[model samples]
Target chain A: MLDHITQTTLLLDEEKCRQNIAMMADKAARNHIRLRPHFKTHQSVQVGEWFREQGATGITVSSLKMARYFAANGWTDILVAIPVNIREMELVNELAAKVQLHLVAVNIETVQALAEALQRPVNIWLKIDTGYHRTGILPHSHEELDAIVALVEQNDMLQFTGVLAHDGHTYKQTDAEAIRTIHHTTVFLLNLVRDRYKGRFPELKVSIGDTPSCSILQTITGVDEIRPGNYVFYDLTQQHIGSCNFNQIAVCMACPIIAKHPERNEIIVHGGSVHFSKDSLMGANGSLIFGRVVELSENGWSEPLEGIEVVSLSQEHGTIRASKALFDRYKIGDLMGVLPVHSCLTADVMGSYTTLDGKRLEHLSGMGQL
Target chain B: MLDHITQTTLLLDEEKCRQNIAMMADKAARNHIRLRPHFKTHQSVQVGEWFREQGATGITVSSLKMARYFAANGWTDILVAIPVNIREMELVNELAAKVQLHLVAVNIETVQALAEALQRPVNIWLKIDTGYHRTGILPHSHEELDAIVALVEQNDMLQFTGVLAHDGHTYKQTDAEAIRTIHHTTVFLLNLVRDRYKGRFPELKVSIGDTPSCSILQTITGVDEIRPGNYVFYDLTQQHIGSCNFNQIAVCMACPIIAKHPERNEIIVHGGSVHFSKDSLMGANGSLIFGRVVELSENGWSEPLEGIEVVSLSQEHGTIRASKALFDRYKIGDLMGVLPVHSCLTADVMGSYTTLDGKRLEHLSGMGQL
Candidate 1:
């Protein structure tokens, strides 16, 4: 193996990562809520240990592979964030047998399907659509909830744990007040359902997610647990929405400039969509830059550089057009640090992470999904 | 291990891949020229092996990692198509020692940098910018050529092998005549310098590359070799430019539809920028879909069903929006085959390959440039 590697690899600052974890854990502690931070952002076992150390026992994952990966590495509490598919019941049963696996049910049909397919008991959280028109049951759909509750009662293995709402729309908030409004509406809907079900079912769990809410909100009343994955590696998108400071961004992929074209004012980078991710988070100037152009140092994730736009990206090549008029900005032999538009995607493609101080850490230990 | 594993992997038809190789090889053979297909598109040993099987001796790669990957995989004659950087002299030396590596030098500075760095003799190909202004030495720069030639004569290790040009602008060609025009202009520029130094340097080589001209044009006169990589995996872009027909397209990454929103006429897929690559190829209705969603069968890549466009892509998820007319056409759980606008970037992400018949193959053997 080559000893001195020059290729710009994904550098993880363990200290910064732990600090981000501590901040989230502290936030949850202050709010008196359970902190089941999403592990999908940093799928490394080494990175996960940081959260596990900071008093986080439960975690969220996007897929079955991630659930299995973490469970094998001693993470007993794993929540498969997507709506549970009846097709994956066998794997879910196997995973639940190994540990405490919580899942989401967005539709009554899927709840019925899960009831019919599951041979063992599985904790199921009913997903409510507060505002994000992406996934989950509509908040006004009383008929749908009644049907799902009816289906859950029929199956001994199926348990309705709580009403889960992922306020993903909060990330699109333009201002703090917009985010605040999203949280207010989210909490209001949960309380409306919680009050109705309290006398009949006092064990109902109310869980809220979405990094922007979990990161910015000082308190989360009526919510039992908060799952925010991207807090560990805050990105440009998070920064735009004022979720976390630029200094708190923990993980960044180091990319090298392969070719610098002065005529077009563009520089081709080795890190492309495959590595840096094709996430378009444009700025006020209408300049397109999917990920932030950061600087690298001996210690950890560096400060963000201005007047640099990652204008366009090909598969394995990123095309950055310098906004700076100075020609001495970058050359063929320079390495640029990139903070992604969203850390969730950035951390996913890298597969593994190493510290800025040259500490190689194995992170692909227990991914809920691969 | 599971009895059978299925994932969203690149499906490269070995037969078609070889056929493309043979077609290009035959074109070179008829013209009494050399064939050098660029390996940047399908960075696979198996694909390279197929090229070799079809009589390809020289292959082009964009990065040192790719050059190393192909060199280690038994490709004796390889060309690193990217311009030489002074910082990567050590890697160039190691690569030059391993094989008959042909490095591209765009200017007097790069050529001079190469001579001073490499202790051993390295075959240098002078990259000329005839039109598409990305990289390469200006075609009409006599001062630059004089400086390059002066250094080459002084330093024996800096041997001038050939003049190479990439007619990527041919991709924008509208008709068969436009392709011929691009071919004529490209050959005109390569011939311009070759004739200038014909008697001065008898052993100088001349080559022009781009899949559009190599795949379409029947003639190769002044040009001595070809390095068209995208021809192997014909994309929608190629099909649009009339470079290759849809039937000739070999690779397709089959993505899974995880969620279907019938009201919105949108289907969320498992493949995103991480799988299908973020390339914009125009759809049938003039809408820009990142890729063409095809009709996938249990057997192989098939004809694309009408009106399935991958409207948007996130890191791990692609939002394929079909027309309301198409919603009733495709089912909820059906797999959709997406044709990448750029095949190379899409293939590199999954780090592996699959066949039309759903067989697995590994492509990424080691780390690429940072």
Candidate 2:
């Protein structure tokens, strides 16, 4: 099955993935904290093993299914990073019985509900709004934290896990320098809280996760654990945001050139938004193309195919505007590779992987999700 | 299972689907032709039943698995609309043996290959390029048409089913009138070829597809069957193209507002490029924000969420910026239904559906393509 696969697939470079693990492991060790990398980005067991090999003892996931999956695969400490919704109590109890389940609570109301509802001992983290206004109770709001902490201390069935923050707000700042400055200030602020509640919640873990910050770490401050997943497959959007260099990018999808319409400055291919998903687009073109169509070289994926500006994509057809020079180079049945603007969307939609050498394998992340 | 099903899911208004079917059925009756609606768009057994109730005896699919799935559920005549990629010869042979399988061939070389490769009598449709140069034998090129006809006549096992042309190029026209003109000319040109091949291939069926033309047509002409799948659930892109108006759209994903980040004018939601795939961002503003996120009314889906602009998206989070009015309207835990630019891409990625009244069910279209 591996040998039979060819074009129109995701290719993951094993060596580069291992390199990313090593880099992240070193960063966590230097910061004197644990590394609980999130599995939401690259949800493959093979990739999960890469993190484990590099000393990832704990992990974070977006859903209960993900937590159960990793736990069955030998991931003992799992954090369900989403706010502990009251409706998911049964699954939480089941998971708590099996592993050290770490649930996130956004407010005192949610914290109180979890404290009253849980039937078994479980660790829970207080979500702090360190400025990602998307979720979490604000650190400045002492009333909110005091109420949550009071309820947790009263509940014998629930263990008080220290505060945790995910500065998802970092992804919004188009400026890379501004992101770093905010991240630096975030760590400084968290350390202040750690000292403030030093004895009350002794050894409380103050964690941080923002792929951009972790991947572009010139300095690691007081963050206890670092979670960055997209570094496994760097994409064009990441490049624009100054996260990972292009050399670190490991996956590419190879598609075929199926048609050429001379009048529209476009050719059609079999790949479309179905294969690539609506992701990042060509700047100012305002079309739906989400990747750079590139030449598939003997070594690996190469330069963007000249004249082939992937202008638009329909459901099953990719519309390419071939540059005058590349128009002649392209024929009806030619093969080309595309570097997706967002690899997470690319890998998720394509649903399978092929190594650069063309060995294909199932993308197991979706299997667990389903 | 039914009670907690969230609004951020595929909800089918079965009533609207039937009306869409009846409308297309009426077009076929008025045109005095057959209708072979493609199943690639709304891949639901229930949707298929609606088409059957409206008197569709034939269907079309993009792959062999799709053909087999439709056949197993009792669709006898199924056209594999994709160019006959002989790589799946075994699957093609298997499907052809059990059902009336129509295979698409554009080049004379492919016709020759079909004749030599399969021992079974395969129904063949020579794809005529009226204008969409994606995949078809050019009807205007007499030499190309003559050569294909000669090959088909020479082959014993190949039975020429018809000359089929999907006027996909009609989609690129600037306005609805231009699209209609392209559709009219393309159909006329194909009918001209039906005359040229009259003596060579008797009992040949001529067909035209491209939903924009067919859906907008108060009357159809010069074709035996109409294959327009997107009409089942017209999208923003379709409505903008003057295909079907807003009230005609039947399917929409109900996504939730997971966070409200007004400072960035963004509300991060759970659905992203993965669910919506990459689709065209169309509006007067010309600022592409991945897609149009709409407000959900109690009766049905509504217009783009007022003052909320979908600016950027990560793998699972669509970040929207809010106008002052939007910020005032949105609260945490609010649900906003997004109307995708392309319904087919969204439908394909979502892979399952729930009714507006909360009935979860499997989607029939995929048939395990992965």
Candidate 3:
């Protein structure tokens, strides 16, 4: 399998990925919640089949283009997890005509526009802000929330589903306890909103999604659905956030060593921002680390190598700072595996993946649709 | 043109791009050096034709894949700027058979491998390190350099073209004076190496490439060729480095405003790291800015908006921290133009571009070959 890679390739360990999916599925089952795993991480129909094998019927995506891609591939229910773009209402009508399309709304104007333009009935999820102030209506913004809900209820083409909150603030936490606390607080606030509207709308549910909280919490209460994407290919950022162990990471970038600099103890690989992205993590010694290095093998990769980390990246060159012992272990023409700091951005940049068994998987971006 | 953008779309100003190309071409002609502009920034056949209109025949790329992409489209002299990846020797041979392939070598073993594997003649450029501690052989490493050059001289199929160095340290400089100083010092070091090797190889030339050096320095000396790629699409990073002004930026991402949050003075756009990339610039007030925001129009865009910047980015969402006036100036469903921090990575991720006059341009990645 390693011999099949001649350039920079993204390697996915299928068994490890399956194990992660099973673990998350079992957790969601034990908590008595629906598992609508986000498809934005892998963005592959093959990986979506794995979720189907785990009895997942509903999925979540980040954009209308992704929702349409999955819907065309036989996914019936899809919750686009971002605010509805009114400029793309034509796509919304097309998608709503085929599948159980779920769109999120944070403002009354967007909901009214959807109600006026949507040709078919679609589920509407009010995007609520628990702690992450990125883009969501606050839980206490009763007037705005009421206005959006009233607009959804007044239209025949709209069905009010529930409230969804993405506790993106959990990513900033460094430990499991903090992540769990944030998760609980988000769930409590979302449930409060659901209860407030349950008398008028009895089918109101609470949905929360974030990798850190979903991976660390044992019993997720007060949430009707769980949507965690990054756990399928946990990366260095998740490991640093104490969400998952290093062994659970299923994706690695296999790069060919192109140049070596012994004077500065740096090795240049053919992988850079084009392959691993410009996302980085600050090392313990106060330097930015682009990725964690690992030793590649026939089957997969070994544990993270000690004292070897990708320090910087250009357009098509990655500079790895290695220790003396690690530097001498490899030379030009060798393949090195690197666990990316953020898997989603890396996967989006790579656009495709090669399994450990040498099977190629296509992504939504690689489908030539844009 | 702005009405055609329904999502995150990369918009190119063809006139500005041609002006940039002509400016660089004029600079190279006046300095009496060849301009082999790197095509890695805009990996498009249409953009290549524009450069050809400016009398650019030789081109530089970062990988063999790009070299093949351009070679198949009728480019004759192509140089792979990074060091040779020995794993893709078969590709090297295939490209060598089609064009005047120039491969960079930083070690003796690579040159030896190339000598044994090539089925046809090829040009070789010894990568020299001046001050950027990235991937290059030191100028003072005469013993190793002599061995590599001797091997290239011994091989009948190998033509030692010259010594090429990418003074990437110029990117760290903040002003024109520092960039010019680094350019002059790199030229001095490359001349020293050429003078040392000119005793055996009288036709040895010197080559250096860095956008800062190429855009700032008025008079280039001691170099036979200049290969600057980023000048064709100068970005916010280049503007911050005093290499180009905001008006000279040839590309801008047209993203739809999806959500607004006046409480936090933030606006959410459809563009994110997948569109603008995670590259950032440190603001004067000690914040990281992902991009500079501007107003989009029918023909093009306006100057950078004052007191408005993209403060953070997610996978599919960009958070713009705007001033009160800027926040209220526009509403959701309008289009906003963002000048990217790094245009190369942004272009690589976008995979295509839409001209201001509503023409679609195809890119290498968007060709669906991978």
Preferred candidate (lDDT higher): 1 or 3:
3
Model 2: DockQ score: 0.28
Q: Which is the better candidate, 1 or 2, if ranked by TM-score?
A: 1
Residue-level lDDT of model 3, residues A1-370, one tens digit each, is 7876899999999999999999999999999999899999999999999999999999999999999889989999999999999999999999998999999988787887887788999999988999998989999999888888888878989999999999999988897888888898898889888987899899988899999999999988889999999999999999999999899999999999998888778999999999998889989999999999998998898889899999999989999999998999998899989999999999988889999999999888777744
Q: Score the docking of each candidate (DockQ).
A: 0.28, 0.28, 0.74
What lDDT score belongs to each candidate, Candidate 1 first?
A: 0.74, 0.71, 0.92
Interface RMSD in angstroms for candidate 2: 4.3
TM, every model: 0.89, 0.84, 0.99
Angstrom error of the Cα, residue B93, model 3: value is: 0.3
Instruction: Give fnat (model 2).
Output: 0.18
Error of 2 at A214 (Å): 2.2
lDDT of 2 by residue, A103-184 (tens): 8776565666667678778887877778766666666666666777778888887677777777776765667788888798
Q: What's model 2's overall lDDT?
A: 0.71
